[model samples]
Target: MRRICVFTGGRADYGPLLPVLRAVQKDVALELRLLVTGGHLVGQQGMTTERISLDGFRVDEQVENVLASDTPVGVAKSLALGIAGYAEALNRIDPDLLLVLGDRYEALGVAITAALRLLPIAHISGGELTYGATDDSVRHAITKLAALHFTSTEEFRSRVIQLGEDPERVFNVGAPGLDNIRTMAFLSQHDTSKLVGVTLKTPVITVTYHPATADPQGSGRGLRGLLAALDRFPDVTIIFTGTNIDQHSLSITKDIEEYVRRREASTRLVSSLGQAGYLSLLKISSAVVGNSSSGIYEAPAVGTPTVNIGSRQDGRPRAKSVIDCGEDEAEIAAAIDAALRISRDDLPGLSDTPYGDGYAADRIVHILKTVNLKPLSCKKFFDLPDSYFYMCSNQRN
Candidate 1:
């Protein structure tokens, strides 16, 4: 049995990995070494660690951090702590392969440590571009470090090969988030409202905005623009999910609390919603207003219109239901206006979401269970000279 260790540090990554993790757990040939770290371990997002155990998966290891800082300096120190923590954990678990998802610094920390230990890594969602955050760089860096790639789209697959990885190693499976959409049981609007402890509002909006790590002062400015835009829809019940913990997290969290407090009657700020609740809320929401990839990837599956603000998702593929706007008061407000006009029923047929069709997890599990293990731990880039294939064909002729 191959000891496969999956590392997930945030809800954003963990929720999507659930399907694949479950598949791995049931596979007779695999030993699922589930490594929990970062945001999933912290109570910042509503005690996800407890939820993980409740979900019935046995946790293999819990990596801790000594630093609680959110500044760049503090984050750097955290990375140092993560490297130390992960290295020690690996020493104990000693898995044959490491699985990492997304581009968080915590994910990067594990990938770096795994690389040092000569452990083969299977990276998901690599080669996608999100120009707004330093995630673009981190994603690419992980792509280079990983031995196997499970990309969400064909476009990303080609880009990964262009980065000099063997094309055979890159598999274009659809986005794993689509699997939750395909399978999860969602609460009805009334039940959802009751579960959330709020009465149902006709035109509800769900907003999730993370810090634009590219710009130092951009988080506050962009958030203010979002708040000002939402002011126009005073009657709308806006459900806001907390931002990812990053260098600018403290400021974003503070501002969101202030925004909710000021608009207390109409706004509710939730830290984490398990996959079912979150997706169900999106299903009934009039618009998902934010720059998060969820707006680009998952909102379309639920037939919700998305008012995507600013450059956070600049180069990523988006469905037609997604309305792009700048972080200006007028632009955001206008986009929200257009979003409100979008008929929910018409959304399913309108845009073609390039992400996936909800079967990514099976493909990921198949690869993990079947792929040969030993040679993958040590890899070499097959750098072929330009026109070498053509020349070889001519010589053969």
Candidate 2:
């Protein structure tokens, strides 16, 4: 059996990795080894490793590396600690392949460890852009480190090839996060209400915002603008999810907590909602408002309109149902108004996303089971023909 070690740092990557983890475990030819670390072990982040156990998956290893501080220095220290911890854990588990998703610092540390150990790495959700955060650079860096690539769209596959990875090594398998919408049993409106500790109400909006590490003003200004916009609609029930452990996250959390405290009657804050509750809430919500990738990947899949605020999700391909707006209160409020105006009946067709049907997990698993691993040992950079560059230059002229 080929042992595959999957690394999940926090709730952000866990949702997309859940389907692939299940597929790997069920395959007789594959042995699944799960390594949990970062925010998964942090109490403030909901101690989500327990949730993994609740889902019937055994946690093979736990590495604690997230520091209590969210500063750039603290995050850098945590990344160093992650590399050390992952090196030790990986040496003990020693799987044939290392599977990682997305562009977090923890994921980058593990990928670096795997690269130094000469272990082949398989990356998912690569070749995507989040220009407003450092994750954009991290994602491209991981793409270079990985041996096999599973992208969510044909456009992403092309981007991976442009980065010098061989075309054959990259596969456009759609997005695994959407798989939950198709397969998992979502919570009922009542159950979702119970999970979030709020009564069901119309004009409900789910908010998830993270710090844009690349932004000069940080996440606070954008978040304040968002809260002000939400204030414009006092009757709308707002459900806020916890932010990821990024730089300036503490400030963002504090801001949200204070806002929720003032509007306790109409607002709720949840650390983690698992996959079912989150998707369920999306299905019933009037609109998903925030800079989270869920608004780009999963919301439209469930026929929910998204009010995407600011440049955090810049350069990502979005559905027509996604309304982009600036960070000003007026801009955000206007965008929310536009999103709320979208008719439910007109959404399913209008939200036709380029991310494929929700079978990405199956495609990723099939490639892992059947692909030969020997060629990965001698990885090479694919060079585009000179004519390709010449054609680009001619087009520019």
Candidate 3:
């Protein structure tokens, strides 16, 4: 049996990785090794490793790397700590292959460690662009490091090849996160309200706004503006899922707590919704109000309209279900009002999601089961003409 190792740093990665990880575990030909780290160990972010055990996946290893300082210094220290921890873990586990998702800093550090260890890495959701954060660059970097690539869209697959990965090694298997929504049973309206501890109001909008991280004003000021706009809708029951761990992540979380306290009955603030609950929340929401990729990738598939704020999701494709706007209160409020008008309950005719058809996990699982890992270790840079530069003397004069 091939030993397949999966690394999950926190809520975002684990939620999407869950279905795929389970598929690997069940396959008779493969063994699953789950290494949990980063935000799973952090207290304020709900220490979501508990969610992992609750969901029934056995974690094989744990590497604690998240730090308390929310400044640039803290971020750097976290990365250094993650690299050291990952290197130590990789040596101890010595898996045949490493599987990582998305473009987070944790994935970047781990990918480098695996590459040096001569372990073939398979990367999912590669070749996507979101210029607002440093993550954009990190995603492309992982593509170059990985031996195999699984992309959400065909366009993204092309971008991966453009980065010089072999086309035969790349697969356009769509987004695995969609697999959960296609398979999981969600809570009904009454159950959802009971689980969240409030009677969700009509025109329920689930809000999760993260900072641009690289933005000049930081996430706090812009998120505060979003809250101000949300305050305008006193009657709307708004569920604010907290911000990620970034420079101003805490500031935004604190502000949400204060705002939710003042509007107790009308608002709810929770740190991590654990995948199933989050998808169920989207199922009942009138509109998803946030800059999260969930608004772009998963919301449209569930037939929920999204009011996307700011340039965080600047370059990604959106379905007909999304409405883009600035961070200003007036603009955000107008967009929310427009989103509330979407009448289609589940998946609009000609849906807005360009991600996938919800069978990504099955496809990815099949590839993992059969793909040859020996040759994958010897990778070649398949450079495209567009990616090369002509030195002044190399050009015909």
Candidate 4:
């Protein structure tokens, strides 16, 4: 059996990796080894490793690498710690292949360690652009290190090829997170309200803001603008999810805490809602508001509109349901107003997303099962034809 070691850093990747992990574990020809690290181990991030176990997947290894501070230097030190911890874990597991998703620094550290160890990597969600955060560079870096690429869209698959990865080894498997819309039993509005300890209200909005590391002002300014915009709708119930463990994340969290405290009756801050609860909330929400990629990828899949704030999700393919705006209070408020105007009757069409048909995990598993791993250790950069650039130029016109 070929052992596939899947590396999950935190909630961000874990939600998408869940179906992939389950597929790997259930496949007879594959052995699943899960290595949990980063925000999964951080208490402020909700210790999501427990959620992994509760979801019935066995944690094969746990690496505590996150530091108490989220400063630039602190994040760098944490990356160093991650590299060291992953080195030991990968040496012990020594899987036939390393499977990692997204562009988190922790995932990059894992890829680096695996590359040095001569372990082939299969990367998911590669070749996507989040121009606002440093993840754009990190994701591209992982693509070069990986042997096989599974992209969420054909455009992303083309981008991976543009990055010099062999097109033959790249597969467009759609977004695995969308698979949850089909497989999971989502909670009802009443159940969701009970789970969140808030009464069901119309025009409900779920907010999940992470630090846009590219922003010099950090996430606070954008978050403040979002809070002020949210205040414009006094009747709307706002549910805020935890901030990601990135630089400036602490200040963002603290700000959200204060904002929620001030508007206790209408706003609630939930550090972690687990996958089902969160998705369920999205299903019942009037709109998902934030810079989170969830608003870009999953909200539309659940027939909810998204008010995407700031540049954090810029360059990513978005459905028509998404309304983008700058981090100014007026801009955000206008976007929220536009998103709220999207009627329930209009949402079904918006659910037709570019991501996929919810079979990404099955497709990913089939390829992993059948793909020849012998040639993966030796990668050859596939240069684009001269005419390819010409075609791109023509399209630009």
The best candidate by TM-score is 2
Model 2 Cα lDDT, one tens digit per residue, 1-397 = 9999999999999999999999999999999999999999997789999899998899998999988999999999999999999999999999999999999999999999999989999999999989899999999999999999999999899899999999999999999998888898878899999999999699899999999888948456789899999999998999999999999999899999999999999899999989888889999899999999999989999999999988899989998889988888999999999999999898882238778898999999999989898787568999988998999899999
Question: Which should have the higher lDDT, number 2 or number 4?
Answer: 2
Off by over 4 Å in 2: 349-351
Clashing pairs in 4: none
Off by over 4 Å in 3: 218-221, 345-351, 385-397
For model 1, the stretches where C-alpha displacement exceeds 4 angstroms are 349-351, 388-397
Question: Rank by lDDT, descending?
Answer: 2, 4, 1, 3
> Per-residue lDDT of 130-177 in model 1, one digit per residue for the tens?
888888999999999999999999999988887878888899998898
Q: State residue 326's C-alpha deviation in candidate 3, in Å.
A: 0.7
Q: Candidates' lDDT values, in order?
A: 0.86, 0.92, 0.85, 0.91
lDDT of 4 by residue, 1-397 (tens): 9999999999999999889998999999999999999989988878988899899999989899998998999999999999999999999998999999999999999999999988999999998999899999999999999999999999999999999999999999999998888899989889899888788698799999999999847456788899899889999998999998889899889989999999889788887888999999999999899999999999988899999988889999888899998988999999999998988787763247989888999999999989999999888889999999999899999
- Ranking the candidates on TM-score from highest down gives 2, 4, 1, 3
In candidate 2 the C-alpha lDDT for residue 61 amounts to 89
What is the alpha-carbon lDDT for the whole of candidate 1? 0.86
lDDT for 303 (candidate 3) = 86
Comparing candidate 2 with candidate 3, which one achieves the higher lDDT?
2
RMSD versus native structure for model 2: 1.2
Q: What is the TM-score of each candidate against the true structure?
A: 0.95, 0.98, 0.94, 0.97
lDDT of 3 by residue, 1-397 (tens): 8999999988878888888988998899888888888888888778898899998888888998888877778977998899999999988888989999998888998999999888999999999988777789989998989999999999999889878899999999989988888888988888888777789878798998886876737345557668888877878998988677876677777778898899888788877878888888998999999889999888888888899888888889889888999878898889988888878754572245788888888898899879999988888998666424554336755
